[model samples]
Target chain A: MDTWEKLDIGLVMTVLGMGIVFLVLIFLSSLLGFFERLFGTRRSPAAQEPKPAAPAAAEEKPPPLPRPPSKPAPEPAPAAAAPAALRPAVVAAVMAAVSAYLQAEALALEPPVKRLPDDLSFWGRAARLDQMMARRL
Target chain B: MSIGESILRFLETMGFAAMTWQQAVMIGVACILIYLALKKGFEPLLLLPIGFGVLLGNLPLAGLMAPPVYETVIDPRTGQAVQEMKEVGGLIYYLYQGIKLGIYPPLIFLGVGAMTDFGPLIANPRSLLLGAAAQFGIFTTFIGALLLDFLPGISFSPQEAASIGIIGGADGPTAIYLTARLAPHLLGPVAVAAYSYMALVPLIQPPIMKLLTTKKEREVVMEELREVSRTERIVFPIVVTAAVSLILPAAAPLVGMLMLGNLLREAVSMQPILNRLLKTAQNELINIVTILLGVSVGATASGPLFLNPRTLGIILLGVFAFAVGTAGGVLLGKIMYRTSGGKVNPLIGSAGVSAVPMAARVSQTVGQQYNPSNFLLMHAMGPNVAGVIGSAVAAGVLLSMLG
Candidate 1:
């Protein structure tokens, strides 16, 4: 076929192709809309059953609900109190352990604690010690 | 033979001795594609395999894409001549049969259906219009490709024009499927153009979107979509398959497979056993098909056939198709915006071009730039998935007319 003839065919195809595409999608869109109306209304009553109770619960429990938020503040306080109550016992145990270490030191049963370099930070010292230990291993 | 003769024969058999300038150029093209896929991250899953396939196809004397050889043999007992297999074809040659026979594209669609969620589309069915609008790019580009025939050294027949125009659909599988049927010769350039443009969606769409809509329309924060029920999701794919297949029986392969995959995914909620099939379709099956399809399509792009004025025209027209499609969607969106009393964001309309989450994300990103609190991702997804159906339908229309 000649170029012009092909062009004419092309023009027709362009219209047909776009027309069919639009028609198909529009058909699908409308079908979906129909489904929405069909299924949507059937489920609405089940969905709406909860609506009345939600507002009634809200009205009756508004004061009670605010207390829950404030209740969390004091909840953490009891947790803190338990730790505070254990402090004296912890200190006494630590003191007893220190005395036992002192007695051993007096008897020359152990070496004195090694002083770490002042220039190194705790993390840096820990890293350096880790490297040294690794090398030794 | 003497040692010197033996050495000379070995050297002659080397790939270096057989290499042509065309083959070298193809190697360079392959490298460039590889670089784009790796460094620039342009559709790496497909492009990377395609680039390597191009490399393998162009390697001197590799014969990786060679067809099977047949030989005539005499049957001594019967004193008759018969054809026998002399040599097997190359790996890619066999794998390419899937494409040539038009099998892979629909399989890929199956995977896409499994991965996709149609709830957003069901929630806002109006998005289907945007999907249809975006298909305007395909037909417009078909005319543009035909018009290119008027130029010197660039002629496209109606079938070739149709294949070239499908690149505007911005869908890789649909483009491949249509091109394989309509214009197999144009598959390489068309696939490359379609994928490259799909990867470039962010770049191509924003300008058209900005030009079409005012800032207020872009900034329009859309309302949240209503919840879609399990029953609607289950019914959607079945209804679509029946409707589309009835209307355009030609599109049944692609649209039917896509809806089937969607049904497997959606119906799994009730059956639970179908989840295994859904998982396979979504992941393993699709991944295998993608690799095979990518390599075979790339192998078709030999240096001599690919580097031509027609390819250049196809590349140019591809961008035109994408731009026109985006504009079409946005224009329809602007209409929806007016009709809906500014409830619809025009930006989401561009997602109708069917690049999936990428196009939808672009809508969200652009919408957010205008209004930070605005979220258009879910809203845009409605049209994004709808575009897949629209493009498949458009492809069916073209195939019925041209095939």
Candidate 2:
């Protein structure tokens, strides 16, 4: 085609091309948002609100009175009571099996009573470190 | 032999005697490219090899890019007389075949996809509109290219104009892909302009961005993007590919290969061997392909073809297209800024021109100049990646309409 004819064609294309691009992207954005809402891991606020209260209600019977040293004493009782509820020596046997699997001494296999919180921030940092190492390699 | 006779014989056989004025001029151009690569550090990876290739191609009587001649030969396997085209040209000519047959650009897209991350785009999907807006340059330049016929020795057909217009995309593979398909003869200049402008993104985009944006707008800090899930990241490429494939099947190769590479990158849990292969494709394979593609494209710019008015026009139009694309993106960003109650930074609009990390980095740099604490790199990356898909879609449109 001649230059003028071609120029006209180009003008038509610019409008149509840009328009389609915007339309497609808008559609995609809406569709993606729809998918996200459909498959989201978050529970509704109404569903979650009922759950926390139930746990709190069951724990209230043990705390009619509060004394300073007694508070600390009651904390260990839960752990000690949990084992008592189970079969006799079952907890110890489980620990013994773990120790055997680890190939450690029987006394050394006594699980630490002190529980450490699994820090999410620490895991995030570790993941970032791994990514950085991979990139460097 | 007499002394005069010996001197005459040597002079007749020397390269200087055989070299035309055009070839000499091309050699000078090649030298300038080499200087740019070495001294100025302008895309040295590609430019150095390209400059060297130009020199080698321009050497008269070297037969480096001589057309092969066919001869009838009896084939042992077929037991018949067949016309066989002997390999008469040099290595660069054979390498050029990859570009001619439209092989290199798609392969390059694979590497680009492997390196790219779609998280930014997925986190802020609205940036896709900005990416589409940046393509205003390609169409605007198409009109400009066609209108340039009013000037002497500067007529571009629809095909040529389409090829030239894509330089606005600020993407090397997309530009090369379109040019190779539509205007193969114009490949050298189109490829060079696209790459040169891409390398100059830091310099070319900032002024336009600043002109279009205010100091306050540049300093606007965007809210942190929500973290995209792994499932969303994995689904993105597949969805885009399926969508584009259904709409514009012509773009299937460029878009498909790009998505394939991204799938490989995101499929980290597939296997260690597969991950290693993906890494190799991103680094080693891309590096090797780039060297070959650069040199081959350079070899095509022989003196007669490259020294014309059309080549110069294409280069000028390329920069203009880039500037226009930047402006278009920034304008859209301004609109979004006003609509969103000033939550968006207009500086990231320039990243919509899609030179990948380079344009995004330019956005970050310009934004930082206004406000040091305002980090726009991650935000700009959204439009940066969207620009890639936008340009590919634009190419597909042009191909379908004009191919």
Candidate 3:
């Protein structure tokens, strides 16, 4: 084939190749969407509803605990200072372990939590700290 | 013969006496590749073996890549002429048959399929578009390579151009598979260029990604993906394999093997026996294929053929393909960002270039640079895995057209 003919074929290939790729993938996307509609709803309600309620219950029960204040009230300054000093190291260690475990377990299991929210956001960090404090109490 | 004459004849047979400047230069190139693999840690698993293969290939007297020698002989009883094997070929020549026969790449894809988690992809299927868009680089480079036929000493047939273009897919096995079928002559340079650029993805993709997107677009924190059900995951490989194979039968071997591996991985939850198969595919089988594929491919890079203007063109076009692919994905991402009202992070689009988790990680790193809280890894993985399917499809298209 001459240069122009080859170039024409090349252009045709360019269009045809890109067109087929898009078509196939778009088909796949819609198929996945269909699957989500079909199967996702079945599990989402059962999986999602209980999680928020359990966390909420945990939140409520933590506030009612009277043991935390009683033990630390007399030495509040030192108690606050000690945890403040130790918090960074502990959080860092925990984050490392969590990330390592998540990476190792990513193939086999669903993640325990969907997102690594704590390290990335201030509110998440605060919520985690609150949970830790409540657990200690 | 005198002792001195015998010694002198042995000296004349040595590799040093037969070595050319091109061979010397190729050896230097191999050493540099080895250094990059060892010291700088550039895709050490493949590059190290490939570099050593180049070294072995260039040694003039070694004959490591020699083809089998055959002679015509007459059978005494039958009185018919038959071809007799006079000498067996070299080790790598035998290993190279795996690539030449189109066996190794699909097997590698099987391992990749077994190892990959398609949950992220199934959750956000629109990322498939980004994967398809990145393939724009492959076709664009195809046109560019064809245009290079006008240049002096750099003629590329359409088959060669297609093979060269696949390097832009940033997928080493697919490149080799396509090249071995279409333009076996260009296999060495194309494979080298493909793997080298894949290793350099972090360096190549970011600048284009940054250039294409705004600061706000890069920092867009995407919502967490919905949970994919076990049934959905299991059905995925089957459906995809059926759809893609029916649509493009030429892609069956690759897509078929890939889905089979994935089926093994995902179906283990139901059939416990499949776990053994999945483990083998993911680890041992892949490792053996990788070594053979790397060394045999590198052995094809003989001094005379490799040190040429065409090889240089392939190397240059490789980077061009990667740049355009990154740009293509990022541009599509920009469109998605606008359409989604800034919900989509455009940075994740660059991961569409099929370097597996490496491209995805680059997206994450670049996104984190702009916004500390932005977690694009899982989001980017959607496109990252999608790119594999996209490239395989692109290869199918080219093969149907050219092969």
For candidate 1, lDDT tens digit of each residue in A76-119?
Answer: 22211222223444545544554453332322223333335579
Best by TM-score: 3
- Model 1 chain A: weakest 10-residue lDDT segment is A71-80
Q: Candidate 2 residues B32-97, lDDT tens each?
A: 888988998877877887888788889987777777778999999989999898757677778988
lDDT of 2 at B126: 80
Q: How many Å off is the CA of B103 in candidate 2?
A: 1.0
TM-score ranking from best candidate downward = 3, 1, 2
- Per-residue C-alpha lDDT of model 3 across residues B163-220, encoded as one tens digit per residue: 9999989998899999999999888789888888999998999899999988888889
Ranking by DockQ: 3, 1, 2
Chain B TM-score list for all models: 0.97, 0.94, 0.98
**Model 1 docking grade:** acceptable
Please list the C-alpha lDDT of all candidates, in the order they appear: 0.87, 0.82, 0.88
Task: Compose the digit string of candidate 1's lDDT tens values, residues B1-403.
Answer: 9999999999999999999998899889889888989999899988888888888888887888999899999999998999888999998999999999989999999999999999889999999999999999999999888888777889898889999999988999999999999999888889888988899999999989999999999999776678888889988999999999999998999999999999999999999999999999999999999999999999888888888899999999999999999999999999999999999999999999999989998898889789866778899999999999999999999999989
State the displacement of the C-alpha of residue B8, model 2, in Å, after optimal TM-score superposition: 6.6
> TM-score for each prediction?
0.82, 0.79, 0.86
Clashing pairs in 3: none
lDDT, residue B239, model 1: 95
Query: Between the candidate structures 2 and 3, which one is better when assessed by TM-score?
Result: 3
